[model samples]
Target chain A: MTLPIETPAVLVDLDIARRNVLAFQAYADRHGIRVRPHIKTHKLPQMAELQLDAGAIGITCQKVTEAEAMVDGGARIKDVLITYNLLGEQKLARLARLNERVTVSVVADNATVVDGLAAFFADAGKPLTVLVECNTGADRCGVGIPSEAARLARRIAEAPGLRFGGLMTYPPADGAARVQAFMSDAKRLIEAEGLEVPCITSGGTPGMMQAAEAPIASEHRPGTYIYNDRSLVARGVASWEDCALTVLATVVSVPSENRAIIDAGSKVLTSDLLGLTGYGHVLGRDDIRIDQLSEEHGRLVSDGQIGLQVGELVRIVPNHACVVTNMVDAVHVIEGGAPKGTWPVVARGRVL
Target chain B: MTLPIETPAVLVDLDIARRNVLAFQAYADRHGIRVRPHIKTHKLPQMAELQLDAGAIGITCQKVTEAEAMVDGGARIKDVLITYNLLGEQKLARLARLNERVTVSVVADNATVVDGLAAFFADAGKPLTVLVECNTGADRCGVGIPSEAARLARRIAEAPGLRFGGLMTYPPADGAARVQAFMSDAKRLIEAEGLEVPCITSGGTPGMMQAAEAPIASEHRPGTYIYNDRSLVARGVASWEDCALTVLATVVSVPSENRAIIDAGSKVLTSDLLGLTGYGHVLGRDDIRIDQLSEEHGRLVSDGQIGLQVGELVRIVPNHACVVTNMVDAVHVIEGGAPKGTWPVVARGRVL
Candidate 1:
């Protein structure tokens, strides 16, 4: 049952992954809401299909390329929501092509994105759906206030070949209250303008379970919940066992009594510590600290109490599973501790 | 003519890159020593060939796949030294195949690696050359002391189908004194054992100029010298103008008066800070601080003086050029500020 794969390879416990898919669907089903798992987590069409089988509304992507990957990679999902500001001639054309494929919608915080998108889709037969991105608390992309969202929504509704698809917000972790307050005001303003607010999508894995706390949102988008990471575990949103993705690395070099090097470095495990102290958590070894990572080598400093032999396989729980997933070209999927097959990370490096 | 490459793409200044290669080669030639540029920095066959054109003796790779990449990707290198301890039957067979393609040598610090390699190459007609790696000051890999290296060298010499190829050490930056002392002792021990000591390779870009001061070394391997980064700039090993690699990202969202979001996030620019405070240095915008990064978003908080607008292209000098090169599949090569062609990062993600 041992995986006959190379070192520094990613392994996904598919049973656990399926369980994660079902568990999130159960959570959403309990709250009488729809679950739309973000495809950015695994970036594989297979995972997206599994989420769809578990009753997800659609797949969520952060960029046009990501959405294109899900559709073309054989996810077979009919609905897609791109949760980023799409701009430029190149991306807008890609967005139009994507919208032609499925019921596609995108979020925009500024008028520039809206104008660019409108210019391309203005001649389309079916109107494009555009969501007004509201800044609940992430402070990255989105409108600052409810009025801004209302104004953007009106602009989308008035633009040719575009429809107002309601509001969307990517709030910070533990900011469900702020989302509730902001989304409620934006929704009220949009409804007062005699426009139908079809969907309000709010997202964040840390605040996933409490997404229903913002009762105004119709659907939720949580990317990392399908894989879960050190950040999610630290926030008590998920336990270590709930994590389906793990990097199976080998002890390549033991430099000293206190230091050992693994084949998984920044290229594999990644430097996204997610505000955690160490690079990753080594399963079954609490004393080993993954203190540093070079491009192709991860240096682990041990407590010197337990000796690790060279060539021993160690499973590592990375700080952020989403970023780790993007680092690799494929993952070796397993079921019941037996190697099943390799799953292509089909959408990896599709940052365009 | 400007490059038609999309935003958030990697750009390589070929003129500066060629200058870096020639300058390092000239230094090695002046010292009457051989220069082997580590392909781990650029990872492209074109780049490796460029180094060869600049008068490098050979190439250095951290993994067998990289060697395979250089040889198969048309670098046409005759000699390659893999500075990693090759393990497992799969990698060994691959290494043998690589050796059949070109002259291949590897490094080993412990008897386990030596024994494993010996077992794999025991029946081969041509003996595989292996170097005893010594840890002078950098506590990452290699044997601890001169005796350990000497013992390993003796083991390599006695093993069937293997040759003791002197010593190699990836010393700490500015540790010429330590490398000299340890290599001197190791060389004396190996020579006393009646084995021909062929090479003594020391490596580190930060200590490139001072490596010649360690008279015990025969050759030097410095990868980052070709594409210097913010780390080399901070350490005074390279100037700002010497940096040849940059990530061209567009300001996607200006969240506030002092905040901007760029398309180059951890996925493109990476999260390898290398002890630097910020992620990267934006060219001509010291007022902008690339304070944080998400998967597809780089959050920049400014001093509110120089305003950054959406769609404006900003070139960023990353913290570590080596890791940045690994993140992209291809880089846009430029000459004299005009668009050249794109160079495929052929060896990228070859962590195995």
Candidate 2:
């Protein structure tokens, strides 16, 4: 059945998604770099298949649960790289089991994590690929310098049942140059020790467009490009039309001349303000700013005093698409304002 | 199987939840009012049952999808009041269909919405109970002032195939004084017009705590009290341990002496900064602040320069519990640092 443009439904523009995949893939191909588009943004196997069809080498997932959901949902990619550092006994065992299903690789910045991974893989009788994560000044994860990265890579190579796959880094915002320099220095230092530096993966959506020009990196993993959001548009990476996903909302109450409340709130659009003042961007109405969001209500205030009648439908492009994807059960694909199909957010809440 | 106290797992303290339910129920009972604790906070049928067991008249849900999930999951309460205004043909039909299985009441502030509800109930040969939502100053989903509320209430009462239950208001932050005055004035106006008002629902966690002392509202529908969050703690309605839910996250990387990255970022703890500066309250360390959050990494900085080692577990009480609840798949119940059974966030992401 065709669902109405309800107040809190997630809308996906499939055409835009397809174009984004092709565009990113073309940029990677031109720079002789493999594009491993991260599935954490859309988390849909159909989108993954489209990326593969457009010449993506593999896919990147943030969690083991997400990777398992993607693989089970018929993503035919042979290689899946988990960009996050895996720790703990349970997570390591899950990682080893995932390695049996696909060519799985994970990142590590410490010897303890490497040791835990080595111990798990050795007992599981499986070979696990490890990448030394170098901190490119994001200050979130990874080792401090290229020397620390090389040392960690050496440890992974020496550890039983673990193979050093190379270096991975999620750079600071718009830090393409820093990533290039760090990866180059780290690759040289690793090879100086006569170690095989096979792959250098640098990723982040903000840097994805500029990643192709970075000659040191062999692969790029960009998650947000597939479903560009308000933050991406503000960053000048993509336009509103380039946004593949939007929250379809309706004006439930137009109590005043300048104020209206929408059914879509933080529960649907998410609380990822992304430095944007409003909860979500109202399509075609730049005059209106979503002033506040309660649990189930989005309060819109218009400085220009636009009159919105109750029951009027509106579209909101969220500030962050990945977080919004995790806030819903199913996302509706729209073509010419009509429903195409619904895709379940299978990895909606796989935060583990 | 035992789940570890990992970083970024939703931890529910059952004892606190039970106490919160009984406290709210007692407030309502003492005031000669009906308590309909909104289940959108916990999203667990077990907790809803606790509220009902503690003398709650029924339960309130923000969406029809939540009501459906609650009713199907063994909530035998006869009346399920959907506190949000219903819009669109699809949702009205769903509302009508819900009346077939359970008692469903909706809120509306517009004539068009009342007509839509009337049409659906007329076709179903049943009367749909509706509360005229009033804007007591929240400026969210309600009619403005007493005159508009009475007018809307009158319209709903006179509408064919619709029964006007009474008035509903989601109050602003100030508290019971404003809501009491508005409700009393609106009730007087509506009753003077020869209309019987059966239900008068007032909303807000902090406001509900003072509801028993006030004489305005006949029913209270506080959603967040079921899983008190950082906002409630800040409002002085709940203490730290009174917070029933928290995101148990692990420190994934200690990038610097002052900064550590957690596995739970905007995706898990959510970007619901609320009025607070940080995303959440760090359980053990008030000195440390979650300075920023990317999609998958929470960057925590400490003023005391204390470092979080890798693999260390920490609990974060999110600024808003309802938003965090929607972000996870299951909540791990914990008592005295020991693991309990996992309960699915059953009605989570039911944003229809």
- Name the top DockQ candidate: 1
Candidate 1 clash pair list: none
Which docking class does model 1 fall in? medium
Off by over 4 Å in 2: A1-7, A335-338, B1-7, B335-338
Q: How many Å off is the CA of A251 in candidate 1?
A: 1.4
Clashing pairs in model 2, backbone N/Cα/C closer than 3 A: A7-A249, A7-A250, B7-B248, B7-B249, B7-B250, B8-B248, B8-B249
Per-residue CA lDDT of model 1 for B1-352, tens digit only, reads 2357777789999999999989888888898878888999999888888998888888999999888988998646889999998889889999998888789999998888999999999998688999988888777788998888888998999999898888999998979999999989988988899888899999989999887899889999999999999999999989889999999988888878898888889998889888899999888887878999988999988777438887778889999999888878899999988988988899988888
What lDDT tens digits, residue by residue, belong to model 2 across residues B196-245? 88988887787776776557778888888888999889988789988988
Off by over 4 Å in 1: none
Writing each residue's lDDT as its tens digit, candidate 1 over A1-352 gives 2468888899889998999889879989999888888888899999999999999989899888888888998747889999888777888888888888899999888888888888989998778999988888888899999888888899999999899998888888788899899988888888899888999898878888888888888899988888887778887888899988899888877867788888888888889877889898888788988998877788888767437888888898899999888888889998888888988898888888
TM-score versus the correct structure, for each prediction: 0.98, 0.96
lDDT of 2 at B95: 83
lDDT of 2 by residue, A1-352 (tens): 2354555788898888888888888888888989888898988888888898899888999888888888888648678999888888777767778899899999998887888888888766678999988888877789988899988999999988999998998886678888888888988999999998999998888878788667888988888999899999998888998999988888888878899888888888877777777777888998988889877888899876757888777888898898888877888997665788989988777776
Q: What is the Å distance of residue B220 in model 2 from its true position?
A: 1.4
